[model samples]
Structures are given as C-alpha cells and as structure tokens.
Target: MRIGEVLHMNGGNGDSSYANNSLLQQNVILMTKPITEEAITSLYSSLSNPKSISIADLGCSSGPNTLLAVSNLVKAVDNHRKKLRRRHSPEFQIYLNDLPTNDFNTIFQSLPKHRREIAGDGSGLCFFNGVPGSFYGRLFPTDSLHFVHSSYSLHWLSQVPKGIEENKGNICMAAYYDQFEQDFSTFLKCRSKELVKGGRMVLTMQGRPSQNPTCHLWELLALALNEIVAEGFAEEEKLNSFNVPLYTPSLAEAKLVVEKEGSFSIECLEASQIYWTGYNGSDDYEVNSGYGVARSVRAVAEPMLVSHFGEGIIDELFHKYTEMIVDSISTRPETTQFTNVIVSVIKM
Candidate 1:
C-alpha cells in the first residue's frame, strides 16, 4: 500500500469525517499536552529567545485537534514568557504536515477563525501552512525546527510492513514487529537531522501494554472482516491481501529504537489507556459508543478498505463492524481499552 498516497482522515466536517470523529485523537493530545508545555518551556529557557520559533506538527490531519494543539502550545509559550517577565515572546512559524491526500483545504479554511480566536486582535504572530508529505522521511531543512509534535500518527508505517503477505487470517501486522522497529528508527533519524541541537519532540501514539502486546482493537476489526468474508460480502482473496499498516509499540520497544538510533535522548515515557468511547466521567454507558468507534475507524481505514474491497462494501462492512462492537461492549466492556504511549525526547 502507498500509505502516503491513500491514507488520510475523512475530509471536511461531515458527520462521518475525521473533523467530527476525532475525539479519541483529541484525548491523546490532552494526554501529552503537559509534556509538550514542559518541553516548550525548557526550550525557551535553555536558549537565547530567537525572534521567531519554528514548530511543526506531523500527521496534523484537518480537524479541531490540529489547531487545538498549536493553540495550546502558543498559550503555553505566552504564559511562560509572562511568568519569566520576558520582554517579548517569539513569533511562530507553525507547519501542519500530513499525507498529501489529507484535507488541507479544511485546515486552511479554518485557519482564519483559529487565528482570530488564538491571537485575538489577529496579530498574525503565528504563520500557519499546510505541508503535504510523510514524516517518516525528511520534511524540513536541516536544523530548521525547534520543536516537533506528533500524536496518533507514528503507529502508521510508511507502508505495510514487509513480508505482510504471509498473514492470512489476522491483519494486525504484529509478525513484522522488527520491520516497525527499523522504520521507527529511520523516522527518528530523519527528525533528528531536521531538528536543531537540544531541540525536543513529544510524541503520542497507540501503544501496547508490555505484559500483553497481543491485545488491540484491531483484533475485533479482524474478526468483523472475517465474518464479512464468511458471509461472502468480501472475497477471501481480497481480505488476505489487505492489512493495516499500523503498529502499536511498547514503551520499551520505543526506547530501544531511539537508543539504537543514538540521536535523541529519551526524557520521558508514559503509558495510558483511553477508551474508544472516551469516559466523560459518566457512569452511564454511552449507547452511541459503537457508532463512535465505527466512525473513527472509518475515517482512517475507509480508504484502504475501499481500495482493496471496492467502495460498494464500505457501508455494509462498517454496519456489521459497528454491531459487533456494540455487542462486545455489552458483554466485554474491558475490551474497549486503547493503550496510548507518550514519549518525550531531546535531540542529542
């Protein structure tokens, strides 16, 4: 699969689009927000404050969450500068990057409103641009970026792992864990070259619990796909050829990859669980949990599914997938846990 060419969140703010279905990713950003603030705070304190700061958000798909992260960072810097009694905070050159197919139009259209809300007076201190590319390789010039943030994105390999064709039943791509390790190391090396010395990065993505790397929400989707094949809704051959290019690494695995690359120092590593249907501090079960999961899944996975199975099967496939998720939630609510790994690294 040409992931950069085909993979993207659903475009626009339609009900099924990623703009509407990205609460999970939002929660991920929230989980890593404090770490990001700390990194940015340390960044300014460590160096003579430049007149401008360059920040790039990788895998910043079009959505509220994209600017939400940037806005928070800007606020953090502004607050920190005030506390330090600095004469002025630096202007920001913020880059929002994603696959070329991403819904950059939506991000661009929303920028005016976001700028107005964030900068109030429309000071234009923050310059925002959509950079269309993959983060697995070099996307910026050497020593150009002072800070980088990526959430819920690194899990997606540049392409499907090698030797993925051997798998027939489960499409988790766990068999190619080593492939993921190599790709992740390469990604870090590329970022290291782009970052200035002492620059920092905070990344949050799907991760596996060390005790049980086998557990994942994809298992349920695999089951649903198998059922579709059994019912002849999708061909067995097509199902066998299709595999999601996602890998949830354990914190240890992530650390090992960074260590092997020898460019970034691992400052912090954390593991947390986020429900597919995020808990809003409510005891009452959300009846719409299944639809929520289905929409989120569709936003990211629909392109791959359509390419492999044809667009005709999408609605029916997700309908059955949603039903299965609802039934599982009713019977085994614990299975809804989605592990998130957050890592903060500094370029050495």
Candidate 2:
C-alpha cells in the first residue's frame, strides 16, 4: 500500500476525530516533557544564546497535542531566557510537519489562538509554517534547523515491508527488524544534514521491551479483525493481505542503528510505560474502559483501515475489537500498558 497516500489520523474535532481522542498521545507528550525541554535548553546554551531558533516537529499530526508540544518547547526556551536574564527572547521559526494528507488546515486555523496564548505569556515572537511530507526522507534545507522533535511517528515504515504476504493473521510487521533499521538509519542521515552543527533532536515512540515485537494491543486488533472475517463481515483474503506499517523496536535495536549511522551522538535513551487508558494516577472507568481505548485506536487507525478494508466494515470491526479488549483486560489488566522509548541525540 502507498502509506503516504493512505496514512493519516482522522481529522477535525468530531467525536471520532484524532483531535478529540488523542488524550493518550497528549499524555505521552506530557510524560516526555522533561527530556524534550532539557534537550532544547542544552542546545540553546551550547549556541551561546542565538537571536533566532528554528525547530521542526516531524509527524506533527493535528490536534491539541500538536500545539501542546510546540507550546512546551517554546515555554522551555522562554523560561531559560528569563533564567539567564537575557534582554530579549529568541525569535522562533516553527515548522509543523506531517504527511501530505494530514489536517494542516485545522492546525492553521487554530494558530490565531495559539499565537495569542504565546503572546499572553510574554514569550518570544513566533512564526509558524506547515510542512506536509514524509519524514523518512529529507524535509528541511541543509543546516537550517536547530532542534527536531517527533513523537509516536517514527515507528511507521515508509512502506510495507517486502515478503510479508505469507505472514497471515497478523497486522503488525513485528518480524521484520531489517526494515526498521533501514528506515531509522535513513531518518538519522536526513536529520543530520538538516540540523546545524551542535543541533539536537528528541524522539519518542512505541517500543518493545526486548527483541520480541509482541504488541498486546495489536494482537487484540488482529483477533478482532479475524472475528470480523469469520462473521462474514469482511473477506479473509483481505485480512491476510493487510498489515500495519509499524515496527516498535527494542532499545538495543534503536541504539545499534544510531551507532551504525554515525551521524549523531546518543545523549540519552530510556524507556517508560503508559497505560492504554492514558491514566497517570487513579484510574477512571470512563477513561480506562475498553470503549475509551478502542476509540483512541480508531482515531489513529481508521483512515488507513478505510483505505484498505472499505468503510463498511470499520464500525463492526471496532465494535468487536472493543469487546475483545474488555475481555482481555479483565483477564490480564497488568498487560494494558504500552512501552515507550524516548531518545535525545546531538549532531556529532
């Protein structure tokens, strides 16, 4: 499948849109906030307080999370400037990037309010541009960016891997480690060229604890799809041919690719876990229920599913998927968390 053409989060602020259902991703952004802020602050100090800063947020899908991330980064820099007692905050040139089909218009429309919020904080003068494209290749001019940030996006391959057609009944490309290495190395090479010397990048994405790629949620999804096929709601052939263009690497795999790429020095790499329900503290049934988790997944996965499986089966698929998830969670509530990898790197 042409992932670039088909891959996008459901757009707009509707009930099922990514904008409304992205609390899980928003929680991730919040979870990794300290690591991201520290990277930006260290880069700024290394640059001896430049008057202007350019930052690119790759795979910046639409929603409050997109601007939520930007707001945090800007706030970090603004706060640091105050700490240094600088006379003026640096001007910010922010590039928000995603696939060509992403909801750029929604993000654009929300910018007026975003601008006002930043101004209200007495932050720096901000300039925003929407860059629509894939991050697997070069998307910025050479030596133009000072910092780069991506969240929950690098796990997607540029395209489906070759020779996985026989791997039926599975939706994730978990067995294909080589494809992720190639894609991730290319990502590093491109970003190395785009970032100026001493530039830094902070990336966060789903990861596995070991070389094993047995993602629990995806397994649940596959089971749901298979059930749909058995019920004659969809074709078995279509299910066999379909696979999610995703690969969640282990920390060792990520470090190996970076070392082999030889373009950036790994400043920090760590793993953390977040519940599927996105609850940080005490769990709320409304947020932690199977329905809530299914909604979040549908918001992110529906566009791609409709592209391949036809729209008629989506509602039934998720509905079945939700019931399966509820059963699974009741049996093994401890396995409901997703492992996340956060890495910070500096151009060598």
Candidate 3:
C-alpha cells in the first residue's frame, strides 16, 4: 500500500480527529521548545538581521499542535529581534507541509485566528502557505529556507520496507534498521539542499533508549490485533501482511546518519522519556484511565487500519486496545513511556 495515499491523521474537529487527540505530540513540542527557540535565536543572529525569513515545518499535520509550533518559532524569532533592538522584526514566509492527503483545510480554517494572534503580538507580516508533498524528496527551491522545524513526524518512513513479508503477527517495524538509515539519510540530503548555509533545523521524533528499535506501545497494539484475529473478526492474512511504516531509532542510529550525511553539523541531540498518556499529573481522570492513550493511537493509526482491515473492526479493536493498555499499565507501569529524540542541526 502507498503510505502517502492512505496515511493521515483523522481529519476535522471531531472527537476522534488528530486535532483534538494530539496532546502527546503537543507535549513533545512543549518539551522541545527550548531547543527550538535556541536554534532560531542562533540562526537569526548568524543571519545578521536579514529583512525576511523563510521557515518550513515539514510533516506539519493539522491541529493546534501545528499552529503551536509555528507560534513558538515566530515568538522566539521576534523576541530575539527585540533583544537586538531592531526597529522591526523580519517578515516571515512560513510553509506548512505534509502529504497530499493531509487535512490542510483544517489548518487553513484556523489561520485567521492564528494570524490575528501573531498580528496582535506585532510580529510583522507573516505569509502562510500549504505545501502538500513528502519530505523525503525536495519541496522547495535551493537555499530557500532559513529555519525548519518538525516534531513527531520523521519516524514515519517514506514507505514500508521492501522485505519483511514474514514479519507477521507483529505490526511494529522494529527490525528494519537498514531501511531507516536509508530513509533518514535521504531526509537529511533533501533538507540540506533546501536550507540556506547556516540555516537551522530542530526535529523531535519517537526514539528508543537501546539499540533495539522496538516500541512497546506498538507491541501492545499488535497484541490487540492478534487477539481480534483469533476471534475471527478479521483475517489473519491481513494482519500478517500489515506492518506499520514506522521506526523508532536509537540516539546512536540517528547520530550516525547525521554524521554520515555530512551536510549539517549537529547542534544538539538528546532523548527524553514521555509518558504514554502524555500527561504526568494525575489531574486528568481520562488520561489516568488509559482511554486517552487509546484515543491518541486511534487518531493516528485509524486511517491506515481502515485502509487495510476495513472500518468494521476499529471500535472493537480500540476497545480491546484500551483494556490491554490499562492492564499493561497496572502490571508494568515502568514500561508505559515513549522515548523521544530531539535533534538540532545547522546546515553546513
């Protein structure tokens, strides 16, 4: 299956939409805000007070998180300009990019409010355009971008690995390091061409601690699928044929790709753990009950799931998935976390 054709977060403002259920990704953006701001400041300073700045948020899926990232970056750059005592902030040409099938209309609908908020802050004229395509290939003119930001996006491969047909009963792409290396390397090469010399990029994606690329949360989902298949609600062949086009690389793996690509210098690279529920405090009863986690997964995974297994099993699958998640958390709370890798790089 073509991942770009079928892959997208649930659209619109419905309860199951990615806009409402992306707290985990939102938390990731908040956690990495410091790095993002620092990169923008450093890049802006190096540019010697350029009159205009071009920024691209690759793989920018729709929702509040999308605008949140842009707002943070704009604020950071504007604040830095104020620190420099500039008379006026630079004009911003912002590009919001994702697959052709992404929910761009939803993003556009929120732009008036976004523009009003930015305008109120006196951040100067900002231009926003939707660029629909894959980041695995070039998306902009050479040396066109000054700053690039992507959060919780790069872990998705351009496509599922060619081999691994025998990777049945397991939906996670845990054992595909070679494919990840190739995809990540391609990503770096493409970005290197688009970003101007000294331009900065900050990326935050799911990662793992050790060399093992497995994600326990995805494993739990696999278990849920297997259970449903055993009950004859879905075909076992369909289960066997489906492999999630995702890879959670270790820090070492990511560092290796950047160094080998040689088009950028690593500014910062680190991994932090995030709770599966995306909230550490017990203030939210739904988050604590594991329903939030299930909903989050469904929002992202349902499109691909429906594409392969039909829509009939989605409610049942997630119902079972929520129960499984609750049981797993009760028995092994330590494993109820995802490792996130945030890397900042400068174009050489």
Q: What's the TM-score of each model vs. the native?
A: 0.95, 0.97, 0.97
Displacement of the residue 105 alpha carbon in candidate 2, Å: 0.9
Cα RMSD, each candidate: 1.8, 1.6, 1.4
Q: How many pairs in model 2 have backbone atoms within 3 A of each other, for residues 3 or more apart or on separate chains, i.e. clashes?
A: 0
State residue 109's C-alpha deviation in candidate 1, in Å: 0.2
TM-score attained by model 1? 0.95
* Candidate 3 Cα errors over 4 Å, as ranges: 278-288
Per-residue lDDT of model 3, residues 216-250, tens digit only: 88998999999999999999999999999999989
**Error at 197, model 1, angstroms:** 0.8
lDDT for position 156 in model 3: 91
| Per-residue C-alpha lDDT of model 2 across residues 114-144, encoded as one tens digit per residue | 9999888888889999998889899999999
Model 1 stretches with alpha carbons more than 4 Å out: 121-124, 279-286
Pairs in steric clash, model 1:
none
